[model samples]
Target chain A: MALLQVTDLKTHFFGRRGVTKAVDGISFDLERGEILGIVGESGSGKSVASLSIMRLVDHPGRVVGGSVHFEGRDLLKLGREEMRTLRGRRMSMVFQEPGTSMNPVLKVGFQIAEAIRSHERVSNQEARERTMDLMELVGIPDAKRRIDQYPHQFSGGMLQRLMIAMGLALSPSLIIADEPVTALDVTIQAQILDLLRDLRDTTDAAVLLITHDMGVVAETCDRVIVMYLGKIVEEAPVAELFDHPKHPYTQGLLGSIPKIDEKQEWLAAIPGTIPNPLEVPTGCRFSNRCPQVMDVCHHVSPELQVVGPGHRVACHLYGETGTVDADA
Target chain B: MPDAVMETRHLVKQFPVEGSRDVVHAVSGVDLIVLRGETLGLVGESGCGKTTMGRLVLRLIEPTAGEVLIEGRDLGALSKRELRRVRSELQIIFQNPFASLNPRMSVEEILRRPMEIHLRISAAERSRRVGLLLEQVGLREEHRNRFPHEFSGGQRQRIAIARALAVEPKFLVLDEPTSALDVSVQAQILNLLKRLQRDLGLTYLFISHDLSAVRHMSDRIAVMYLGKVVETSASETLFNDPQHPYTKALVSAIPVTNPRLRRERVRLTGDIPSPIHLPKGCAFHTRCPFVMDRCRTEGPVLQETGGSASHLVESHLVSCHLVDPA
Candidate 1:
């Protein structure tokens, strides 16, 4: 069985205008010890989907449909108290911005120890020890000295390491990291990615990584789910997706990035901007910007079909009898 | 082939830490040039002083020691009144577009302030200019009346660009202009910058931590480590053949989207040294993979390699004593 299965999950924000289908009927599964990357541009609902899984989606947002099953237990149907118990223990989330995620007044040690004290019945001494150990594990130098200092004393990269320490403190089964290294420099990003891979190897926990960078996905993830306008347009393994991306949106996203090796005149971006969630286009959501869009795509929405082993795409071009091997 | 629109000689900026005798060596002993109609990328990690260097070029923040020559005039020698006059020729677009824009003012009012302050244009003429600028940035005339909060992030940045162009500045300091936008929006903004430069003949000093975006946007690139330019070369040459170890590590660390060509990742050990108490020799020698014995004692100066006066690197350009000790 999959470690976590999100089935037809639909998260929407109810506003004065209408319901913004942020995570509209998306379904995917994460296996244990696997890094599943969700790649998309901003407002593509990648962050919202991760937030929905953690049950951390704020007000004006609600999971309108679908079930989230973790270890064969329904996460969406859990009661308030039960869910709270599961949050810091069974699962954890690391937000994108470490500067904002941490409290200004509190010391880094206290904040990290609070996470320990939230789930475990331990003394302050034990909590402090665990926090230091976690800090050291995340590669923070002089963990003992830095533990007493406030979050502001640490640099941006150091602050991100602190967040990782807190997230890994409980030995959770899964971690949802939203743009974990986006704020970091390239070398720092590489270090954090290595740390994440190390954590997964040692802890036996899965990760659902969400980022706008396809380069990151190519480097770290085992599988990738391409999201556009709050929907998954393509899902495939990392190597396969890079080798033979089927969806036009995915292709555009890949082609638009300037590789360090290749010289090009232009990075071909998708012609139009992403449609506002309030004014989502009917039929195929990407039809407006799809370079290979057909007339039939304007009136018909395509369902995700398995075109190869462990590869799926939702496009009209591959209507019923499209069987392209992604690994080719 | 083109004249250097802006050049700095030994640019230095030191900030006094509050309640401390020691000062933060924010930007120390830097030299750079921005060519006419060329986008020069200044890339580094946070606290590496890329932003400070950009500000020094615009003279927004006064440089403690150095000569910032813009179009043949030394900015350091200029008086307050003269600097104000020069300010109209050089402008800056900040990293956070939302924070940079005035929340209380509409887009039209924001655009109008720059023109009113510097250009002395009539009210009727200001309105027309603002409308034309909005249309130029791909925004409709209807958007001028709306507040910044009403527009998307990409639109807000376009407005910021319009405000920067209000004075018809020939030189622009774009500090991470596209870093705040999404990927697709980043492409749009970069394309817009390229197009605007070609059309308006604008020179740019683009500062960013995103190397990939910087590589895409810049004509020449400078890799900055703590408070200094480690390497400077043409964009293609720098990307293809990085001379400095820091530049090589930076380029190597950039995750390529293609999986077929997976390069071995070289993880740079140790964090960036504190700018307050920098290393004895090279600031990056603490973390550099190719550190020599002399690197820990004496500083290296930026020198030309391969008889090419354009490509400058602080470290030994090719094989050093640390590598091939023949």
Candidate 2:
């Protein structure tokens, strides 16, 4: 069995306007020790899906449907107390913007120790020792000296490493890192990504990496799932996704990036902004912006269908020679 | 180039440490010229003095030394009244659109205030100009009444751009204009800036840490390091053949989207050294891949490289050590 399998997950927010379908009927699985990249633009539900898996969605937002199966147990079925026990011990999350995620008042060492003791039945001294070990593992210099400092004392890159250290304190089975390097500089981003890759190689934990940068996914992930308006539009191995992306949205996203070698007059942007979740389009969420959108796409939502080996795309343009009409 | 839009000669700025005798050398001995209707990209890491150079170009902060010339007039020597006159021709678009904008002012008010003060336009003409500027930035007329909080990040940036345009400035200091935006929104903003540049014939001193964005928009790129410019060249030439070790490391660090192609990572292990007390010789020597003994003690001057007459570098003065002395 896969280490984690999310089947038909639907997370929504009960807002004043209506039910905002943040992660509507999305499903993917992470094999043991696999790095699965969830790539999408802002509001594509990539972050929401990861948050839903961890049951960290705040009030007004709830998992309305689907099962998050981890190690043969449905995470959605667990009670609050049971989920809390499994949270820090069995799974940990590294959020985006470490500057905001870390507590300003608490010392970095004590905060990391709190993460350790919350999951494990350990003394304060034991937790501190483990925290230092984690800090060293994440390539922090002078672990003992800087451990007593606050988050603000560290630079943007160092704070990110601290967050990673906290995430690995429990040696969790899974790590859901959501856009961990988004706020960092490119050079620092490359370093932190290398650290994550090295950690994955040495540990048994599966990483559910969520990011909007396709380049990061190409470099780090073994597999990728492309999300669009709360749906997995494409799923394939990282190599396959880059080489042969089937969905129109995925193609547009790839085209939008300014390649290092090529100089174009304009980056090919998708036509429209992401539709508001409160009034999501009925048939295909991306049809409004898709260049190959068709009449059928307007009325019928395409199911995820297998195309090539280990590749799946939720578009009418693939499978049984699925044809898409030219949109004008 | 008597009518060059903006020019700076050996511009130097330092921030004093509160309780100590030390100072933060934010911008040190920088020379730059932006001709009429040109975009000069100032690229560097954080604390590398790119933003400080932008501010100095517009005289937003008082420079400790050096000259700031706009339209062949020395801004540093200008009186308070003369400086106020210069402000009408020079404006800045900040990095964070939300922070720079006044939350209390409506979009129309924000745009109109600049014209009312700088251009001294009548109320009816001010309203008309605000509407035209809004239209120029792809904002609808209805958005004029909305406050900064009522718009998304991208929309707020458009409003910021409109406000910047309201002054009818020939020179614009765009300090990381699209860094806070999404990738698609960034493309939109870039396209908008390009269109505005062509339409208005504006000269831009664009400051950013993002090389990709800089490459897209700039005609010439200047690479800054620890408060000094290390290299200045055409964007394409600099990216293709960077002579400076720091510039080469920066070029190689850009993440490639192609899965098949793997690039060598020039990982700079140590952190960027403190600007409070920069290295005596090369500020980048501590993290440079090819470090020589002379690099620790001898400072290098900017020199024209062998590749192009336009290409200038300050490290070793040459790629080969034998061709040049320390």
Candidate 3:
């Protein structure tokens, strides 16, 4: 069985203006020890989907309908106490900003130990030893000395590592990293990504990596789900998605990136910005900005359908035809 | 060779720490020359002094030492009134458009303020120029009446650009101007910048951490380490054949879009050392993969690599013990 399965998840923000369907009807499955990437821009609901799975949506936002099945148990159906026990024990999250995520006053080592002790009844000494081990594992040099230092003392990269160590303190079965390396430098980003890859190889934890960068998705993820305006527009294996993106949105995103090897006079940028969530389009959310917008696309939404082996795209162009040659 | 529109000779800036004698060596002995009508890309991680160098060139923050020469005139030696006159030729567009632009002022007012102060233009002329500037940056005249908060990230950036170009400046220091925008929007802004450069004959010092964007915009590129320029070369050569160890790691670290083109990345270990207590040798020696015995004690100086001198302005220079002797 898949380690985690999300089906028809709907998360909405109830504001004075209107309901903002942040994560509107998204579904995917994460295999054990797999790195699944969720790629989207700011309002595409990629972050909200991950937050929905973890049941971390605050007031004014609620998960209206969904099933988050983790290890064969529906997480949404669980009570408050049961859900609290699951968080940071079997499932953990790493956010983008490490500076604000950590408490300013506490030492990083103490925070890791607290996470470990919250779930397990281990003694102070055991937790402390395990914390040091985690810090060392995440490539923190002079772990013994640096363990006592507060989050303010650590650089952005180092703080991110501390956050990763905290997430791994309990050996969680699943990890959801939301733009884990976005705030870091490229060189430092490479290092953090390497550590994540190593962890995947060594441990049984599945990673649900959420990011806006297609390059990061290509390098780190095994499978990718492209989100647009709170919906999953395309899903495919990493190589297949990059090689032949069927959805126009995905194609635009891939084309927009300035590749390190190739130089072009003009990047084929998408025409418009992402639509405001409260004022999302009626039929297909991307119909307004899509290059090949059809009359039908403005009236009816497309459904995610298998177009090739382990590849799925939601677009009117491929609705009737199972596998239309997108390039041709 | 094209004339050096802006030149920095060993420009340095040091900030004294609070309640301590220690000083943060933010920008140390950086030598750079920006040729006319060319973009010199300055790239580094945060706290590597890319922004500080940009600010130093414009005299936004007073440099502790060295000279910023613009068109053969030393800005430091200029009188107060002369410095004011020189400021019209040099302008900067900051990274955050939202914060940099005043929320209270309308778009026209913001763009007009520079013209009113620098150009001393009449009210009617300022309005006409504001419309023209808006049109140039791909914004409509209607946007001029609205406040900055009403515009999107891209549109706000357009306004910022319009303001910078209002003074008819010969040079611009674009400090991560597009980093905050979305990928698609970033492309638009980049394209706009390039178009404006061609149309107006503007020289740019494009400061950004995004290497790909830098490569796209720069004629020549300079890779900076902790408070120093580690390498300088033509854009194509720098990307294709990075000579410095730091540059090599930076080039390899860019995550490629295609999964099939998986290049082996040179993973530099550890965080960048703090500027207050930089390593004795090379600032990057602590994290460098090719650290040697001599690299532990002696620092390297920027030296010209073996290449034809057809383009003296674009010659490749690297600062590494392994590449060239100090």
| TM-score to native of every candidate shown | 0.90, 0.91, 0.97
TM-score evaluated only on chain B, model 2: 0.94
* Chain B TM-score of every predicted model: 0.93, 0.94, 0.97
What's the lDDT for all of these models?
A: 0.86, 0.85, 0.91
Q: Looking at model 2, what is the TM-score of chain A? A: 0.94
Ranking by DockQ: 3, 1, 2
lDDT, residue B87, candidate 3? 97
lDDT of 2 by residue, B156-245 (tens): 888989998998888899999988876667777888898999999998998998887788888778889888888887778778878787
Looking at model 1, what is the TM-score of chain A? 0.96
For model 3, the superposed segments whose C-alpha errors exceed 4 Å read: A320-328
Error of 1 at B56 (Å): 1.3
Best by TM-score: 3
Q: Which DockQ value does candidate 3 get?
A: 0.79
Residue pairs with backbone overlap in model 2: none
Q: Where does model 1 sit among the CAPRI classes? A: medium
Tens digit per residue, CA lDDT, model 2, A245-268: 899989888877777877776777
Evaluate residue B34 in candidate 3 and report its C-alpha lDDT on the 0 to 100 scale. 93
2 or 3, which is superior by TM-score?
Answer: 3
